[model samples]
Target: MIRFALILTSLLGLGITCQAADKQDLSLLTRTAEQFARRQLADSDAKITARKLDPNLSLPACDSLEAYLPPNGRLSGRSTVGVRCARDGWSINVTLDIQLFSQAVVASRAIRAGEVIQATDVQLQRVEIGQLPSPPLGSIDQALGKTPVVGIGQGIPLRADMLRAPAVIQPGQSVRILVNGDGFQVSGEGKALGQAALGQSVSIRTNNGQVVTGVVTGVGQVTVTP
Candidate 1:
């Protein structure tokens, strides 16, 4: 009787060990599914849920340890039979794509594909949309064109040969001059001879035949001295 009781107890312990191993395998499957869902489907602030498939529906066959055992019938006892967990692992499979948007205003005008766009360009477009004021026209260079000419006096007769034509002057013109007994002075008036652009050098002849060279500064001004 004592030997029989001991044998029964040993069998019970073996059964408990087998049940624990099965539970561990099931837990592993659940964890793997969760990881897949987190990585593929709900990466953003979006929500995600999953469902397992039923075991009766085309479950994978689990391998039995007996297949590897010798014909002598010694049991290896390794088995692979299992229930289908969560769509058999299909619910965790997912794909994600992200899109971005800008808050900046765009031009109402038609935009060509592949054209590089900038903030200033967008602002100009917005002007057409009447979302913002029209950009100011005629940059400083344009304003300089409309500038008036300054006058030179004190009987300092301009040199006819050196007399840079007044037409050479434009708004905001300047020039350098070596005056009669006055040393060097830069002077010129509007457009440095009207409509003259910046950086153009012209010859100015003083009353005493002194030749001076200068750049247009304003509509009627030129710096001749320096």
Candidate 2:
């Protein structure tokens, strides 16, 4: 009877040891998943957060852990990190909540549609990028000289979709048409057939009664390519 009791005690001790080792393995796996997530996410300034695994969740011990992102996984917002132990045929996924803060352009005052953006009309501010309805303009250089497609209220975040290059040439305006070939550069006067922004294509009616198409290269210049 004494020998049997001793054997039972030893078995119980062994079970406890196994349980502790399993917990350590799981902890290592979780840490690995977190590291993988940090590397895959785009925001260098992002703050990462994740919930602790349930204490009662039971998983078999794994020889190794491989962390990966699932298909169609995004780095922003709510995301999941998958950790697998192929040797043990067991896997778990960790869900993470991420937030990124970055500089964004905001309207200093109400802006009307078709109005050109001015340097003083916008300001840079640090905002939670993850919560933006759309990606906001990150620099003042991007906002300057762009015309708004719609009116924006004061303090509103400025998005790239809302603005465009302001027209530099209007219909019936006189423009210089520059024609260039392998070794020849020539210039002529023409009438713009339509409004065009810098770098946009414009149709021109030359003084010689010839209609030509060219790209608007400057405020009053069009470059014709053959």
Candidate 3:
């Protein structure tokens, strides 16, 4: 009787082990994670590496597995992927690393602050732009006529915040002013009291000495309405 009981217990344990192993396929989980990461960065060139789920980690037999990213998660470099069983409602996080690459505008040579960017100053290169806060400029045309707010190193990627827009109207410069009503148009001349970029507001001191705020519409021009 004792021998029979021991043999039955060993068989039952072996069966349970096999059943557990079949419950989850670790390889499938890793692949799901990789696919999810790739989709998130489909617009850019990215290479992803996902760590395999641990063999010893036990999960319920999931009928449908879905992968997701965490809120505010960084898409480049080391990141986490969350996988959930759609049917069972159990979720787990997996580790993943992504190397993001894109063709972006970079300084071909060192540029100084306040220097007007020329066609030869910037060029596009396929470079690793890991977790950039701002998207890099992708073309020389986008960088042309823009001056750096600060000195930038050669080969460094160019972003919007790094450059300042060329002011269309400078302080104390003569500016053509236009005043528009419901239908009719009026025009005058004023001295620009402040510097402004295109589409930015600037104070215009009219020839009559009354200051009016207007938007910079073009070089040496501001527009206002009475």
Which residue segments of model 2 deviate by more than 4 Å? 1-17, 23-29, 41-43, 54-56, 130-135
Residue clash pairs of candidate 2: none
Model 1 lDDT, full chain set: 0.34
lDDT of 3 by residue, 69-131 (tens): 889877688899989999889888888989899999999999999999998998999988887
What is the C-alpha lDDT profile of model 1 across 42-66, one tens digit per residue?
Answer: 4333232323433333323232211
Clashes of 2: 0
Which residue runs of candidate 1 sit more than 4 Å off their true CA positions? 19-24, 52-226
**Residue by residue across 1-226, what tens digits does model 2's lDDT show?**
9999999999999999978776645567667777887887654678777757777777777767888888998656777888888787678888878787788999999999989888999999887788777889999999999989999999888998898898889999999999999999999999999998988899999999999999989998999998
Q: Assess the local accuracy of residue 127 in candidate 2 as a C-alpha lDDT between 0 and 100.
A: 75
210 in model 1: Cα distance from truth in Å?
Answer: 67
lDDT of each: 0.34, 0.86, 0.90
Off by over 4 Å in 3: 1-17
Candidate 1 TM-score versus the reference:
0.22
Give the C-alpha lDDT of model 2. 0.86
Q: Positional deviation of 141 in candidate 2, in angstroms?
A: 2.4
Residue pairs whose backbone atoms clash in candidate 3 = none
